[model samples]
Target: MTLLEKLNQDMVQAMKNKDKDTLSVIRMVKASIQNESIKLGKEHLTEDEELTILSRELKQRKESLQEFTSAGREDLSEKVRFEINVLEQYMPEQLSLEELHEIVEQTIQEANATSMKDFGKVMGKVIPLTKGKADGSQVKKIVEQKLK
Candidate 1:
């Protein structure tokens, strides 16, 4: 099923179960998707477009979670953590660290990237390959380590 269809189904389930958190998250995601479609003047988003929106949403929540934790706002951080979990359900399965490392290594070799100077070349090639499956920051860390 399409992401929109899945979201609609889950929204209904959340309502039936009286799951306020899940319901709110789903509504927000739906709104974001709809807004993106409207902005782009398209009735339906491509899979890549949808994935981009979901990834943006996930990134925002994770940044908020990090800020909250650093600021000692445990209550807010917990809520953001839950939101992250909800959003993750819609994302493609994440790559394990080992898998991510392997992909980065391969990309580095393909790009002939040596040392930090070829950081951009390696990252440019790697990001598209791992986009929704791996966290960009984590991939960067691994690349930096491997290059060093």
Candidate 2:
């Protein structure tokens, strides 16, 4: 099933099972996605747009979790973590380290990126290929190391 279809299915299951937390999180996600579409004045988002929205949501939750944890607010941190887990259920499988390494090599070659000065060209190729799969910061670090 597509991500939105799966989200709908899970929403029904949450309601049937009387899972308040699950239901709340799912509703929040649905609302967030709908709001995005409304902001765009569109009937539907393309798959890439949807993935971008989901990734942004997950990143926000992760950052919130970090801030809460650093403040010793375990309760809030756990809640953020729960939301992140729920959002993650719909994301594409993350790229493995080895997979990222291989792609970085290919990107380097394809860009003729001989030094850090050519990092932008390398990243231009890498980002689209690794979109929703690899972490941007991680890719940058590896590419920088390769260039150096």
Candidate 3:
């Protein structure tokens, strides 16, 4: 099923199951997708666009979880963590270090990136390759290490 359809189905399930936390997170994600569509002047978002919105929301939750934990707010942190877990359920499976490294190696060769100066070129090619499957910062670090 499409992401939006899956979200709608899960939202209904959450409501029936009285799963308030899951329901809240789903609502937030749906709202973000709607906002993104409106922002881009599109009636419907492509799957890639939906994934981008979901990634952004997941990043925000991770940051909030860190902030809450650092501030000694265990109650808030736990909730944020739960939200993170819920959101992650919809994300593509993350690439492992080995898989990411292989992609980095291939991208460097494909782009003929020979030095740090070519970092942008390599990244431009790599980002789309990894997209929702891998974290950009992690891929960047790997690319930098490899190039140097």
The best candidate in terms of TM-score: 3
Task: Give lDDT tens digits, candidate 3, residues 1-148.
Answer: 8899999999999999999989999999999999999999999999999999998998898889989999999999999999999999999999999999999999999988899999999999989989889888899999999999
lDDT of every predicted structure (CA atoms): 0.94, 0.88, 0.94
Residues 12-93, candidate 2: write the lDDT tens digits.
Answer: 9999999988899888878888899999999888888888888888888888998999999999988888888888888899
Locate the minimum summed-lDDT window of 10 residues in model 1. Answer: 105-114
- TM-score of every model? 0.93, 0.95, 0.97
Clashing pairs in 3: none
Mark the regions of model 1 whose C-alpha exceeds 4 Å error after superposition: none
Clashing pairs in 1: none
Q: 62, model 1: CA deviation in Å? A: 1.3
